[model samples]
Target: MHTEHDWISTPITADILRGALDLEHTAHGVLPHRLPAWARAQSTDGQLAMAEAQPSGVRLAFRTRATAVELDALPTKRVYVGAPPRPEGLYDLLVDGRPAGQASVSGGNTLTIDMTTGSAEHRPGPAGTLRFTELPDGAKDIEIWLPHNETTELVALRTDAPIEPVPDRGRKVWLHHGSSISHGSDAASPTTTWPALAASLGGVELINLGLAGSALLDPFTARTLRDTPADLISVKMGINVVNADLMRLRAFGPAVHGFLDTIREGHPTAPLLVVSPVLCPIHEDTPGPSAPDFSALGEGRLGFVAMGEPEETASGKLTLGVIRDELARIVKQRVAEDPNLYYLDGRDLYGEDDSAELPLPDQIHPDAATHRRMGERFAELAFTADGAFAGRGA
Candidate 1:
């Protein structure tokens, strides 16, 4: 009944299975597909199906190899946490909930999980590749969990199986540019990034160009977007520009136009949406100031001043509102000639009403729950049949 090809089909190695498995969870944060109500009714042992036919909230793929592995993969699902949970970190490789290895996340975004040690912790370093080795000959599946305190991006995995290539089904590409918030700052996972979530909801591919603190309308970033391929595009501006106070009104206006001009060089007719900043009560119209804080180290305390927040912004100067108004005026002039171009008020993405319900913990980035809400709203407004910039070629 079973053919040899099936058994020897690259052994169904991990790399081959990358981006295929997803963890579907409920609003209550429980994996429902893994714990289907019907399955629970049928058996007392309720082991949910971690790998199923439907898309998962958590997905993984492979990246590269380390310490002699047959293959490597990336995680389709990426979980993002603002801070590490413990010094030991929180990435663990569990075989049926039994610890097979340990992982530690460090430097805020890097993870070092020991597949053999059964203990992991968070450390300080840059984000890097995750490696796995010494697999049992017949191991069928593996699961990675982001512990309660830490957040992680499932960057890559390794296996020996041949990967089934994803067919390019002519899905329209959605290119997005923004700041740390767009980079997933406080979101729960990579898939939960508003752009990623919205892309999934709207059945589009995503090219997330969100860079933390680097969205100051740099010429390089503009060129990068201009050269990248895409069927549709959007630039979420304002907040970063305002926060950084990178330019004055005259410079800002020309920069916005230039950014579009650069992108137009590559995507002349693509539907381009320019989004303003979302609601930030304290900083909406207020300027920033140099604020110092005391760091309570183990032995003693240390004083430090934040790098940004110039002295001129101490009294309601250089605010997001100013940037938004300027961006809106500049985009309006450009849209006259480019009917395909569009503008989306950031308020439509996240408004004062929503902010009341989901306050920004840092007065900047939205938390995981808020990210979900923003993604849902964005899809509803921007992807609807009669939406302002809908039906453009993907």
Candidate 2:
């Protein structure tokens, strides 16, 4: 007698799929009711708390059934990060733990994973689509690794499923914006970014807009958010603005207002959150040049200091603290009319306690461990059922 395996067109259930496509929900009535499809089983227990301060690695794995194989399938996989470095290798497309392909790392800093037929190499460019082909028939598991050193964000995923798209069963969508810190920097994988982790814990979709050196309340960014669809929204300000001294109070306030206004155009009643910056001793009260000190490290060492002369602060140049204070003030004013608006102090996400435990190797960005801590705090404060922003909107 001969036995043979049969191909079945069984529908994939939410329980069987893993990795970033999994959905979670922390609170019941928050704004955006869908989390990123890519956030699945993370290291964080549902508790979503932080204790460490250095960078830690995150690995996300999921299995899916393939009915057939094709040469031209544009599968969409989006990974968000806080300031992804230029030529940064953050995505590794693997099949059966073997290299399927790797994302490009270029001179410009942006976190994106797009797969195409090419040699296994890391290239760089803006955040966008990743294509994969020649998949082995049957059930295959795909793994996505996020940055290990810096924070990261995960936005969305799209694939050509012969079946109708499954309705999202997670919590509300969580939109976030910030500088490179929110972008993936020195991360080992795309799924391990802190924002991606937090979204997993909170159970919400993520719309990450953490631009490198460009989170300075740009009209284009605000317009992007305004046009995009979301249920919950957040803006992580400071750090970049202070380090770059991009604008003074005269312009920063109005610019922030305008930014929020544009977003409100799309999500008038959505829960909007405003976040400040994490702790950086060098930029605490000083400003300018957020670069690291390569010379200070003897070997295998990284050092960082606030750029520019110390006297710049005296001339009304911005500092991290200044930006935080202003952000708080702006949020307060907006909340008066927009009750759904909320504020989360950056220090709360990563404070002096964390700084003492996890000193910035370069005094500029947090390590992998710190990213985990930040993600936990964010999920706890922003996504918990009893959290501050919970139940504010249906």
Best by lDDT: 2
Clashes of 1: 43
In the range 235-259, model 2's lDDT, one tens digit per residue, is 8887777766677667778888898
* Residue 252 shift from truth in candidate 2, angstroms: 1.5
What's the TM for model 1?
A: 0.62
Clashes found in each candidate (C-alpha, N, C closer than 3 A): 43, 61
True-structure lDDT of candidate 2 = 0.56
lDDT of 1 by residue, 143-255 (tens): 44332223333333334443343344577877777776775666765466687678767777665666555566766567767776777788888676665655666677788
Q: Model 1: runs farther than 4 Å from truth?
A: 1-157, 289-317, 392-394
Model 2, which residues run further than 4 Å from truth? 1-64, 67-167, 297-302, 309-311, 385-394
Candidate No. with top TM-score: 2
